[model samples]
Target: MSQAPASFSAVTPYRPSDAGRSLMVNDKHRQILDGLREISQESSSRGYHAKAVTSAVDGLRGCAFPVNSYLKDGNPNRRCIVYPDFEIEFEVGSYYGGPQTDVSIVDIRIFRSETKTNTRAALWNVTHTENESGSEWKRSRDPESQLKPTPKCSGTENDSIKIGINGFCKNIDHAISMLPSHITRGNETSLGKLKSSGYQLFYIPQSNSYFRAGWSFVRDLGRTSPSDLKSSQILASHMREAHENGLFIEWTSHRGGSKPLTQAMKLLAKQGVNVAGKQKVFLSDHTSSHFEADRARRAIGMNTTDSKWHNSTKGIAQLVGGQIFGGASLACSINELINHTKREELGGKIAVIGSTAIGGGIAINSTYEKIGKLIAEHGVSPALALSVLSVIGKTAIVGVAAASIPSLNENYHNGPQDPIKNLGNKIGKKLIPQG
Candidate 1:
């Protein structure tokens, strides 16, 4: 390996414990590294060297400090170790128009940090550049300034340490600056507050599948007034939990172009990341693409095509409709019972009302249960099924009520009279003609 910079010579070589190695090899870590490799190779082929470098560095940042703590099996108490001006070699298949077997010596900064419960073993890559003026802290952002010619690997096969380029940052200060303002702006005394803030790195998993992982800065946006802070904090907490549980993904806001979000989603899908039906994704209201995102997510196979707002509205409508239908049915049933048994005794009236109520309740409950099962097992549209079944149920309820009215009237009027005998007597009197 190339000699460490004079300023970093005092830094010791990184050696992770066995526990750390296990943490590093977890699925999340491997997916991140694999994604970075994909980004590097693809972006380099397209001559987007700066993009490749920056994206790789950003991927590294995703594995750092408190962010890693949120990752699966990470140690929250582990301290961060920074290796400044570290050098490593990368074998590239192609570089600009260089030879196929060219090797590149890349100067990277490495950081070792722990997850929540175990030390993470992965080495993070960062790159720093000094301008022509040679100021230590000053770095150029120019794309051309970031490129370097290929060089042979300095370390031999016998070297104990082997490093690959996963990601890099310009410097430690740059990394700190990239953090959300809430954490970085607070004073040392607010360290506890910072720790409790629940800020962590989350990536768009779909983007990762396409080799271009998109990251978001997730924290309670402190831009609001103090009055809104509590609710904002709660929302932030829920969002963080959702992301950590793989139930949600978020996309960065798109600034311009009509339907840019849709186009971007399409591009992602075309690039081999399945965007449909995988996990719930959050689109900022600022983008005004809520409808667009839903359409894209559905077209791309996302789990649900409806927005939360849309679903909520549908639910409210269904609830209101059900209530109105139930109230009307109850009123009609009561009115029918009262009118049909006007001459019946009080005890008989009470019996009829109680029996009718019990039967109606049982029937409604059974119908709803059956409908629910059908929707769950057969992939039925809930709205359609409920609407159709509800109409059928209401009709059946009214029919049962109306059918019982005649029997109830005959049985409870004066005495238990036989309807067939009464009909025969009336017919006999008509035939005898008052003889």
Candidate 2:
């Protein structure tokens, strides 16, 4: 392994975590989730993100400082519940077993695909670069190699720089079913493995899938229609099986205040998802001083209405062990503000929201949704699809992030539809590229 960076700074200033500090969670906004009980009574159907954020804020804040001194598992934060502001699901199998996985994503953008700009934005650049096998390439020459003339390194063979390739299809099952054939043909291999330690999946849709149900609908985004119960059994079964298999069943996501978001969260639950998280803000009543002061620190954080507040349902958090952390989901977008807290009162009470299956899709956008589902369903093309999905997710998110910047007016516009969008999507009625 390569040596760690020698001069890496391993310390953060002893600044307290506050409502304002949540801005650091992402490059976008600043916020604080004081309390959650209130929001639940207000909004009836925002979805998984709402509930997850509410619970996350309440739970995490409840445990953040109760134990000043750290020991081990005995302490509240014995485990650093590091919620990487983003995630993308990688398929493992069904409620049973398998080597390959289906691809999918859980995101807010899926529902927002109606607009032409959003649709264009959803379509992302997919690049298929060179892929190489691990066979050693020795420079040493015997009779054959030495006799041949050395190739000139004019320093320009774009083809030499390898990249990952993915094959997308309209029908998810169709795409997944084609994985083995591609593998057998010795096609699409990745050379640039992660150089850093630790494992992480890109939280993109099609890049994220499994299933969903109703109770989750109620628990996650707040609207529980009777129809959702249909898939509950299968979702629970899958979760239980995944738990038993010693794999991560990420039941949490960043979907929206819609029915689909709720459904997604429920499916993830049976998989032993760690916890849910969401956006939140400190709120106060017009009446009492103590009440106003205590508002942001109590169950008041649940009024997730505006973009500045935790806007999803509150029940999602109830599913996992409390893991609420602030989503910094706010209207306050300022770099300096993000780098530093907005007010001293911000830290008086830190809010932590639950996790979710929302942004996982939006970050990757709708174009890849079908691909994301394919992986989850079939667990096929795990490596190639994952690499491609991961890249597209990061790239698209980068595009979103670049736009979300305060300087850019915080509006996402991916531009006109073209080959750039839907990078891996085929033009004709072909599932995989034939050799």
Candidate 3:
């Protein structure tokens, strides 16, 4: 050892500055990184090109580049790292100077194949960043590119290939064949693998198709011991598949127990799954739900429809139809709320209370649900105003129930039908269009 130390040759140390601090890459980014490495190896100067990518990604750890620098009209929180060979796009909540930044890799792309300069930086379209309209290189404006388009979940063409199976898919191969061709190849493959395991494939009906709830399979934990092998396997498979496909998995339980859902999602995150935010997940129309409808009505001090009406076909039309009267009512009400809220004059002594719960709008009793919700949503300002009036002990706050209005209340109390029926018509005119 002493003799070797005496005659040691001077050589450059093989240590990368970001040896311990590397840019975090998601599943999609990881794939792109692997592909880029393969391409770099074929280049004339492999080491130089490969090292450039490493340096570019490592530099992103402490960079605070503007989102606009990548996506022209995207959220400011979205940012990207551009290198000669490729660009790595990511989203972070906020910017701070540190070795580690809270970020999620959204996409990674090499230069366009048609382009002459593979080792040059160039501007890219923000729309292309999401690959919403297909890959960044493809310029087709086909709406199918918009994968999760809600009302038009089947895309612009309503011609979705309907399938009916006589028997359950027994294996992963059968499940793949049964699935609609509309699903991406990667997803179909992963789903096949999942089904190939003991996991069952739950086919959703056409009505609930818009919800786009991914395969709802049950894992029987009763069969397993404390190890819970089956449950663990299913959860791991789903998390891996979802992350690989850049899908956001939102687990829910209708059984009044969130423990299973919470545990599964926690495990997914622990396994490095790209668990997307709630807002990113799309569900059925909010206005269609009675709870949402009631909330909206209370927010604007207007009873658009009764709870019964909100659950029927009338409620759905308000959200679906573009040229229908029900649709007009929703648009008008929302517009009114938006415009009114901007007004400086928010103080008023007159409060109109409406209730369809008792005798439509004819009952003497006010709808507490409506009033309570309104007060709660308006925040402290209204309560403070009422407090000031109470302190004065002179100003009167007139709370007039909608039923107290002579026009809506008089005959309604005597009539068997709801007073709110047919927009206060003596004869019940269809307030909602049947067609």
Candidate 4:
């Protein structure tokens, strides 16, 4: 254990009260401390002095405050507190097990402060800088070691061709010109021809695997505005179309819920649309003007009868214990977000989506009317092939469903031909980089 700073030694050591500990119910405070200790050790091995890591973790412990005061558990930055010289940030959640057994840890950042001449600086120096061997490590001055300055990409022609290393080009000619001659003018898919023809195609340095149905789509439905109302019309129409197409459509609304959106949905429902059976429309209560955070959450959507809303951050949580039909299996937690968003080089969301079998159905069914056109328009690649396969599998399910009628498979083709071969070639090119 390290000594507290002389100036702040009088400050009480931060420890959760019995009630606060009960909040986690399973001891998250210890978990956070353990995680920080492990991270500190790893950081030390990489170069940071162990003393600094210890001091930072200790300082973080000292900074802990009762979370009940804010009542904003959903806020990603809720646990974070910033001071004039330093900042401390962390994440809190128990996403897996019972919601009551969740945990909080300094997942974002711990104590990080600027060094200045003063008592604080002296305390920091004594606590963090000094090594057990009585030596100090200095930052390297080598230009190569330092981060390279971002290149300025200004002006039209140059910007169209090459902005920055991570920049994208709007001008199709410039985009194609940047690609290799073999790929650009080759007998690839429409996407490849587009490049050769000098059509606009934005450059994406990194590709995310969880393409659709990921965290990117999981947006917070906050207070509605004029734009939202207008968008609701579009949404209603889309929902109506999905209903006619016999696709399941479910939506949950918070922030007092939308009346106009509701009305639009009601109108569609009355017009022989199956609005409530397979899909559903979940609603929270109206947002109250005068109420505490917990009460507000209750007024909106949380069922206080369950006793879960009292401790829930901001009142919103997985509805009906994350039931597949009504409740979401995943909550709006950092861990859940990571599962949906995190992408690897070759696999990750891609593999997960492909493996699920649902993604394939979605891909094929989504483009049932325009599969060939899509392949022609977008260049065939490994990713596209996977998408096509997903579509095919989904189509097979639909075919099974429409087997009684048999007309459903009338326009559908037997198997993919040219596009599959083209995708293989593209994959080969990627596997064996052409120097």
Candidate 5:
């Protein structure tokens, strides 16, 4: 045995040639290598979902997704990410020779409809659609045609119908019955499964839906506290159902002051938050400092009623009635969202990217320094950039700031996470957008 060893022992997974080794090799490098391999192996395969997988992978070369691990609604040990759609594994390359490259991959998560799927076919299609929309990608080569054994989660590929439920459309029986006549073959689904069955799926409800019925009172220049109208019943109903169904509740509280975090942790702990906790829960909106409001306004965006274009009649009319405002001074559509997404990807800054504590945004890009400054001035994402959004905030609020001026976002994009270092203040006038 010691003579030459078995052939398998000599085989390394995959390695880059001498020229590919130059940088400090690490796990991230290995993962990128693995990802490359995964993509390469599938390069010549053409299935219903094959093209879709490749398309979704286009924008990833530069924007690598991270392996997100977090506590579920209650189970700390059980977790999953809401963004990644697939895991691309590979070994690292281009530095320190090929031997040091470890095996790794990028974990991707994709969420339900929105600010946001299933079997191999579903997953492939879901990712494919997403990739087609991104403007940051360059297309790859074509492939061969073949069928794959639908890979199962932990070795269970039942080829059953997978229904990804969005929000809490609880009337499962009705939803299935309502499917189009063409596909409803004697209760036969996407798969041959029958017996009127479907798995339940859920997402965190609109965080502040209950808080809005009496908005006339709560929206008093942000004077009202969340504790004023809450009940254990209401809170429990919203947060507990998903838990019962083994579904996770997305925490949607916006970060501002320290109080919000404290209350959120409590609520997440299965405890409820009332409306009057004032400093105990919701933080101040318009703070005493100018920077606080400035940053918040930047993150929270302009109120739907606020004018986006210049005050001039023509500009306001154009902006309000234009794509930015959804043709009516009040609405903004998915098309606008798609445009902004492209802008953000191109390294453009949004005047404001407003969100409630739990409201959604593109992604997390802030560091402790940017967080501290904003919090010291006015608190937000430094800790929690999520919150239960008010109806108006959810429907009408579009984050708008003074437009890209000398701010942390621009600073971070151009500099490093720890930018306060020797980078010096390259901050420019592009911080906030000015009308």
Candidate 6:
């Protein structure tokens, strides 16, 4: 990692006032930003600006949150991660030139202790708009248009707690102007109260020449503090957990060799997360047209011989089978219903419907078994797979019961039938086949 350039010391500190609270950029944060800019510039020179900047931030000491799990879009220029106190947003430029190539801190808003009637009390707030002229940079200035929060920061109950609100606005002025009335209205309104009331907002500076925005929440942050481990270790643990839980993991790596993949698999095996013959792993590499993923597979195999890792062929086959069987069962049920509607005796109609539903249930159960096998084959624990399938199976049974009971009732009361004694005989013959 590159050190912050010495010349960055000459840059003036940014200070902004909110109500009576004054926020200033301290030396440590300045140095961190300066270091980030140095990394960004070096990366931009090599035409790898976005990935390099994000990688630097992800590895920064003290910022140990697992960013990859939440962000899976494979976008190169933007990334966001939330921390307990604050969140960080990175907007990387596409090309090198002028302000487009420059990496600068755009805005920072800190929640401060509230006093008196005014709700807006900023512990730290600064906005830098000197680079606002960059061609790629655009921010919404119309308060009316901007009042409707960004989709990512819409202040919904669950979202406010998990991800909070971090997005872009033209400047601090525009951001303040766009604050929902409820946020700007309360007295003695602390961050905790605002959070409880479900009004959370964070803004990214629009001055930098970057457009795309991506953000993700860390659900496990409470369970495992990022401060406990280095960022790399945190990331590795996240990857292992994702694989063990049957989640699809994807990340962009600029490294030149297969050592990363080999080592990762070895770590997984060491942690007992990868079990041979019990799970299958799939590797995908889009780095080159020569199919480097094949090479990676061989490397992983060499390193972790006991781990079962292979292609997606078996998974695809199981998925196809499940779909085919599920469709066939649905079609058969509908067809049986039609045939039952045509029956002359109400008892016979009800019996045929009952038999058809039982057959459909059997078919659905078989489909669930195939799906469970597919899940288990792909590294998920059998218990987890069975639990999931069990839920689906129970739901299916309830649905079948609900549909059948209504039809039986309607047919029994509404349709004409023979004498009561003959009805039993009619239904018995329809339900059971005789030689």
Clashing pairs in 4: 94-102, 172-199, 172-200, 285-300, 360-390, 360-391, 361-394, 364-391
Task: List TM-scores for all candidates, in order.
Answer: 0.20, 0.17, 0.20, 0.17, 0.20, 0.17
What is the per-residue lDDT of model 5 for residues 1-435, given as tens digits with 9 covering 90 to 100? 112113222323233342322222235444654564466555453233334334434322323322222234454323232222232322223222333322222333322222121111111111011245652211112211111112231111233222121111122222222221112221335323322222211122223332242122223334424432121122233223323333322121111111222222334343232222111111111112233332332331212222321111111112222323232211142223234343212111111122211123222333223322343222123222122112112322342221111122111121111112111112111221122
Question: Which stretches of candidate 2 lie above 4 Å from their native place?
Answer: 1-221, 225-228, 251-435
Model 5 Cα shift for residue 382 (angstroms): 58
Instruction: Return the clash pairs for model 3, or none.
Output: none
Q: Per-residue lDDT tens digits of candidate 2, residues 174-201?
A: 2222222221222223212211111111
TM-score of model 3 (CA atoms): 0.20
Task: Report the number of backbone clashes for model 3.
Answer: 0
Off by over 4 Å in 1: 1-267, 291-300, 307-435
Whole-model lDDT values for every prediction: 0.29, 0.23, 0.29, 0.29, 0.24, 0.30
Worst 10 residues of 1 by lDDT: 159-168
Q: Where in model 5 is the C-alpha error above 4 Å?
A: 1-48, 52-85, 89-103, 106-166, 171-435
Report backbone clashes per prediction.
Answer: 21, 91, 0, 8, 70, 0
TM match of model 4 to true structure = 0.17
Candidate 3's C-alpha runs over 4 A off are: 1-22, 38-51, 63-74, 82-85, 94-99, 117-435
Candidate 3 structure quality by residue, lDDT tens digits, 1-435: 111111122211112254432344545556656665666566454444555565455455555541112432357656554332445666553222345444445565654341222112111111112245642212122111111222212212232211111011232233223332212112457434323221112111121121122111122222322222222222333333434444332221111011222233334444344433211111111111334323322332222232222112221112122222321232233233334532222221111111111112222223333333344343423443333222211111132222222233212121211222212232112121112
Q: In model 1, what lDDT does residue 160 have?
A: 11
- The root-mean-square deviation over C-alpha atoms between each candidate and the true structure, in angstroms, is 27.6, 29.7, 23.1, 24.0, 25.8, 22.9
**Per-residue accuracy of model 1 over 47-144 as CA lDDT, tens digit each:** 35324433433333222322211111253222221211111222122222322122222233322122111122111222323478762322122212
What lDDT does candidate 3 reach at residue 105? 54
